[model samples]
Target: MDEQSTRFETNAGVVAQIRQLPVGVVLASGPFNYPLNECYTTFIPALITGNTVIVRIPRNGAAPHFPTLELFKKHFPSGSISILSGSGREIMTPLMEDGRIDFLAFIGRSSSANALVKYHPAVHRLHTILQMDAKDCAIVLKDSDVEFAAAQCVTGAFSFNGQRCTALKMIWVHESIAPQFVQKVCEIVDAFKVGMPWEEGVQITPVCESGKPAELKDLLEDAIKHGAHILNAQGGRFSKSLASPTVIGPISQHAKLWTHEQFGPIMPITSFSDLSEPLDWLAQNHFGLQSAVFGYDPQELATVVDTMAFQVGRVNVNAPDKRGPDTLPFGGKKDSGMGVMNAKEAVREFTLETVIATTVNDPRNVKALQGLEGVSRVVKGTAGIKSE
Candidate 1:
């Protein structure tokens, strides 16, 4: 935390503010995809800021409760933290409506975020932060090492069974080698192990079916029915412990799957005639959480870095999907989310600012007759007491 704050001061000017008053409460809500992380991200920072925290675990019960509680209890005072399991939004609403909670942070979807904004009490002192939905992309180039790109893209798209908001959902490939790239990527994906998390050799595990996988499959099926290609992961079997990671190819720019955040092991690939095609595709999308690029061209990398549509928490260059460190702020750009999470951003979100000014020297003790040196002397300059 100290190292992060030090970097923040050099980059974002956080140390000056923290040196000032820093006591507040932070209310954190956990997201189902990364339950343990979401809970820890908010809870630790709030506790560090000398503020109490109340965390609500997701309704589906996918939290690392004992480990998290144990870690906090070791360092924090009794009653400084409370992890309540069950009922996410229902439990959160009361805290948002209360002034006792100085800061409120949530990690979920856009719909849930809108609900909080609508239901929250109109108190100016209460600060709210959201790390919600995102539909991320993987831009594949023509000159890229086909096999390496496929492996990287597979890991990026299905490592957490595509449950991460930062996972690659849409893949944009250059039309010059789109067919070859698709074939190679599909072949790699087909061989990925999908089974129990504790299995000897498994790369992807099933998302606890709180209904997300079924909905995502329906979307993929709809895409296929309407002219897209579906490349089923060949070696995987669908069971309670494993999810069938499917790849939908040659997707259109306007497909619903391109715009929505599919929280499952499903990959959708679209071909672009030129670089602008993918950049334009990004411009129209609603969510921007993270993006990965598999290319050798420096120009393309520069273009993505400079584009407004590339706005996201982290940008992966030729690497698989992974948020770098707790030091970097993680969140989305568009309807994907607002505010930030983890590292310095989370700490800033948990605290409030207050400015104080004071005036000394009694009015009666002042010399009223002093000239311009000590006090103001009015001249009859038509504009009344216009002092020099």
Candidate 2:
């Protein structure tokens, strides 16, 4: 923990937020996609900042009664963290209506987020953070390593059954290199193994959802009707609780795949003649969670990336997109989400700043202002003010 302080003089004395205090009680809701990660991203930091929490988690993602929950019980006093489970917003409704919940950190769909804001106008007062759906995209330049980029996109699109919020939902391949890149992507994705859960030879597993396969199929059919081509070997099946990875290519901009957030193993590939076209299309979309691009144009890429920096939360170059390390702040933009998350961001978001001040002939005579442990950087004036 770093000891941070600010020195300034006023009629009364010097003033600064000596400490970042915990905001208050939090109502944290976990997403069904990344349970372990989303949980820690919200609850842990709030707890660290001295705020109690009420967590409402989706049943499918919750790690049952294990260290995730048990460890919290073992260390913290009772009631510091409480877990509530129920379908949809059944459990969330009453909690949101409760006046005692001081804040909310949620990673879920926009419908739920809308409900939270609508039902609880005071939600903003809680300093809430909501992570909504994302229609993330990947751009492949003509000059890129086509095969390598294809492989990375395959993994980014189908890994985790494409349930990840930051998963590659669409690929905008350069028109000149589109055919070859699609061939490589098709070859790799075609060989991907899909089977029942816990199947040894299967590389792709079932979705966390039970009925999402039908939704994905409907979207796929719509894309095809709208001039999209299917690229996979077409050797897969979809059940009520499971769906095989589906790759559709040469999707038209008019297709639903271009607009909707398909949180399944349905990858849509589009071709663009100009690099800036896809980048601009992504910016125009409602979601701005994260994006990736593969290219060898060092100077152009840098300039493009600099422009993209403020448009999205994070940008991955030649690499697959991820939520990022616990140390680096991660969040969404526009309709995707607001506020930020990360151990460091969490500490800041969960705490409120209050100033401390005092007058002293020698600044060292007053105790140095202490800020959040790790994030603080302070200077000690033990010998008093230095001569200019």
Candidate 3:
């Protein structure tokens, strides 16, 4: 068996604690985007905690996580782990309704989560860890180093084909440096080789072939229709791949891309006169997965750290758009996630708590009598006063 499929030997102490808890079968479900890594994150943790699991792999309009299923069968005991295929209804509904599944761990849409809560209310054992959606932002202060800032923004907004939830969908740039930053970012993105995933250092890959590009095209058209300008459009079509790394300039709130999770290679740049506007927008948004702040000013840096409006799982300080410091929790506020999930956090999520107390004697024990000394003194004083 592969290292991930086996029990996590390193977390033996934590595993011992979890084993003491009452855990039953769990249902793990999510899209099949990054099969090996994503499924490993959920399935391995669930199984290691002594909870048998039913893993529902994403369809992805393809083969439905065959590779991951094979891995599960190879490593897990019979009935300890089972694989389910198909969309949510055909697979998840029955699995969730089953009385055996004590909990459900999911990474999908908010609507789906609502339905689970409504239909399976009696599954009090239900525990959900979701990575719903996000309009993740990158705030660039005027003090940022211009060239380095451009490189970071380009990588964040475009890498992994903009498929990651942490990807920088919208960029908030101070007006003073907006023009130069936009030009430089566009230059870097334009020079990127958009090709097959196997190509040498290819930065951008296809999102989907059928109609995803048209959907993105419509979104861009809508932005332009409502007064947003395209800053960079230098990209080539490689067969059916959606490889274009399109970036827009200074989009208004009215634009759809500004308020939604693009989930593709579409970067919208929004200029901020001050941090207040972006903070206002962040507060009102439903999703809060991650945000990147680029600044050198100590005051501005402290403001980002202290701001309640930007409440999220992880906040990057002038770093690349990526998950950080494995020890840190990876989740979000309002709609990004239900609970934390990772390392020690993951084990805790799939566990139960029980407390046991043992005492040698009853309430009349010597220690208990000593505890009543203060009250006894008050009673004696009251009696003596009455007698006097």
Candidate 4:
């Protein structure tokens, strides 16, 4: 436990000492898209904060971690870190029902997250860090750079086959620039190199999740049935796991694609005559993770930022919605997710702040407490100590 303590006099005669302590046991579960990185984001923090961890290896990406079992055992005490395989319901249900887990770190669907939390015997006592579903949007204004916006949208919507929860699932362009924006997006997506991941310069590759290709096809077909068009040349071409990058546009509000997250290489586009259209859509939407707005006009961009600030966790101005640099806080709002996760926030999330205090007149007690290692003295009576 990296302990930092501060002593300060409160109300002239009383002294208070505060520090952080571990939150007991953490049960972490990551998603298939970023199995190792996502799991470690929680594991490293929980372990460093002196909590025992039990990892539920994702069904799709379980092979990669098998070799690292010895590495964890080598660094940590016996049973400090345990990796479990096989059925999630079989293993995780008993753990949650046992009421031993203090923190739940989950990066997956909201439904699964809800189910897992419900299984816990003490729901109120469980601290959850969830990264769930998102239908993130990108808005392009009339005054924006059409080419740049289109390129960013293509990258944001299709990167990792749009598997990321932060990926832009929908795009809205101003009516005046919709045609140009859609054309540019299609051209860029069509030019992408599609092949195996090991192939050189492959921008799109096979999806890992089973039935993902068919699921994307169903969404595309449903959108088409409801008056949407497949704008790209080779869009909607699916062969087993290899589904080509697709762009379906002028999508109807009634279309399933408007509400459901494809989680694949399908870009859904819409046009708006008034700015209120997108704003109102966002206000009514269930998921609010992030949104991207591209324009040159300061007032127009400011309006977007201000309106979306309340609706989503992040608002990207003239850029694609992404989670990177690992320093900034990342998570979602509404049904998208519950808690924030990052370098600093992760540590704070898995730990608890505790205080030890005594009267200043008790010199023996103060001396004994201050003598402890890792204690920092902050005099002149401040109530709280900022985390380092």
Candidate 5:
């Protein structure tokens, strides 16, 4: 991914030539979140690397409008890229168990990921790429632009009803600016629009699935019980039932929302006297996807980058929930997922590396190799005594 080595490399008088050889047939399947664009993360890259792709479109609860499927059908050849449509387990299990499907790329819940790999261990030996849950952290420093940072946090936390894995679920503000920052966040929350997505350009839609709203509700209640103050829509700290685009004040360590990945517009803010406190807190969470830090000092920001270099997949500076260009490697660490799905990385993931070598130790000018093994021999005139 760093482009350090792609074509050839030589070290210690040994030349190692590499080629990208595609995996025979790949099965790319996932949920409807970013349904079209996310599928391309795996499908297109696999295709570009010469692997035939079979995409399984989500056909159940909250299944998105598959415009890409139609586009594929109209233009591409029948067998070049196949599209499968059906309910979840019934259709997926058979394809997963099939031996011919060499590579698997899945995006869904952690439990479903286990089902895909665990059940068909004997048959499905391929290492599956998974993109699952995350509750990302947003660190706001005292020197940072508080209002700008809060605006970015609001968009990141509430957009898509906060369903995105990169959404800012937890916000850690410097203790010096905690009061002002919380007040501003509540002001924006009050102005947030909540209704049907198609009506009046509503900002906060319902949770993608049926049960998720209730789950978010329960988590909010638990956070409140644990001493987190919920800021009502009018920018007042009045205890009430939680709903869409609700903002919560600084919570303790024991709050459920602090740990759980809430797939709805529930924003939780915390204050820290020292930066290391929140950084350590973030490290313990098994799900490491993406995080953001807001600060003006270049040295401090560089330190943050250095600390999070291997901690998360990507780090956003002042921008909130900003996914870079399609060419950028978009992925997560640990429980968040495995392997990046950008064009270059996906191509690498779907393709196998092959090595070709030669040895000058052989006395004979030409030697016989395995008849059936597919190794070839070619001759050429050389001026030097050894084939160096």
Candidate 6:
């Protein structure tokens, strides 16, 4: 609702006003993981920028949104916000094919995003903001503190059962310190408390997606068959929806885990003889969301960081890869995703810049433009601007 306008006189004796305008109706869909937060990250920006939004409740976490229906009805005008439930294909296909959606804000897998985008009748006319798959990696250098690196890696890889898009899916440790780092990681994994989400000290909870445990088990077995060893004693233990954190080390490049975005509680580790091994792997990898490098030498870390910046969207020197703070740019590259999210970026993504120009000599045109500005200011005062 905040009206942004810039008025300036050009050398051509013309006065122009540049403003932001909504991109029309937006169809927003978020993944089951971080359902509420991710969904609002998309639709809230669109709504604030004057676009009507149609939100598709994710199949796994639909119940959490039921409580927000009353809030939406109270704040927005009728038909401004609509929530759709049921099978995604059944509801989304018609919306996309109808060619009414101007913006598509989706956070999920690449395959699902591709299918939904292809369903749109006029692809070129549709603007999309997609946050998809990521196989983020972490590299621990030989001179780094093994204990601290292991702790950071554990938190990054196993948080939310490794379902996060920014989670460290693969880890590369220098050959000299690989064994020590892997041992420390295994110890931390064993200490994690797995139980119901409501438990006071629970660190690992049941996965939301159905059959995810089985899928994770299959991935673990595949890595083992391809020459990786399960380092943790209780790793891969599964009962129904719960799967204990698993650590598989020295994973073969031929293993499925090497290329797959194992969005589960499975930590895959590998060792590198030289820095080139990890850097080359990153170059050849399809995903480019984020990467982490840990080392004591400033120059060594800087070299890796510079190389990783091109290969990924963000690089963490000694911390875990994360989306963070809500103010920073959150996005990926290549097969990982398209477009960016966060406060300012999301607003830009959901709106378009529009310019209105008039000849300075045209008295009538100037008067009309002034009147329109007055009306816009009045409207903004009455509705109050909303921002993220």
- Report the C-alpha displacement of residue 375, candidate 5, in angstroms: 14
lDDT string for model 4 (295-373, tens) is 9899998899999999998999999999877899987899887888888888888888777666766667556545543
Residue-level lDDT of model 6, residues 125-193, one tens digit each, is 999999889999999999999999999999999998899999999999999999899899999999999
How many pairs collide in each candidate, listed in order?
Answer: 0, 1, 0, 0, 0, 0
Give the Cα lDDT of each candidate: 0.69, 0.78, 0.72, 0.86, 0.74, 0.87
Number of clashes found in candidate 6: 0
- Worst window of 10 by summed lDDT in candidate 2: 379-388
Per-residue CA lDDT of candidate 5, range 1-388, in tens?
3232232343554434455577778888767767767766668878777788888777643245365668777877778798777776887788777767788788877778778776564644575678888878888988999999988999988888787878899999999998888888888888877677699868866555666667777887888889977775642221232345788866777888878888777889989998788788778877888999998898878877777667789888898865668689888897888888775677688877666444434423213212212443321112222323
Residues 97-126 of candidate 1: C-alpha lDDT, one tens digit per residue = 665777767788889877776666665666
Give every collision pair in model 4: none
Residue ranges of candidate 2 with Cα displaced over 4 Å: 5-12, 15-17, 358-388
Model 2 TM-score? 0.88
Predicted model with the maximum TM-score: 6
By TM-score, the better pick of 2 and 3 is 2
Model 5 Cα RMSD, 1 decimal: 5.0
Worst 10 residues of 1 by lDDT: 378-387
**Candidate 3 global CA lDDT score:** 0.72
Error of 5 at 353 (Å): 1.2
lDDT over C-alpha atoms for residue 77 of model 1: 85
The reply for model 1, stretches above 4 Å from the true place, is 1-19, 60-63, 67-75, 233-242, 308-310, 356-388
Per-residue lDDT for 32-141 in model 3, tens only? 55654666677667788778888877767336456556776788788888776677877777656655667777777778877765566465656677767778888899
Q: Which segments of model 5 are wrong by more than 4 Å?
A: 1-17, 60-78, 122-125, 234-243, 356-388
**Residue 234, model 5, lDDT:** 43
Off by over 4 Å in 3: 1-20, 61-71, 121-125, 235-243, 308-310, 362-388
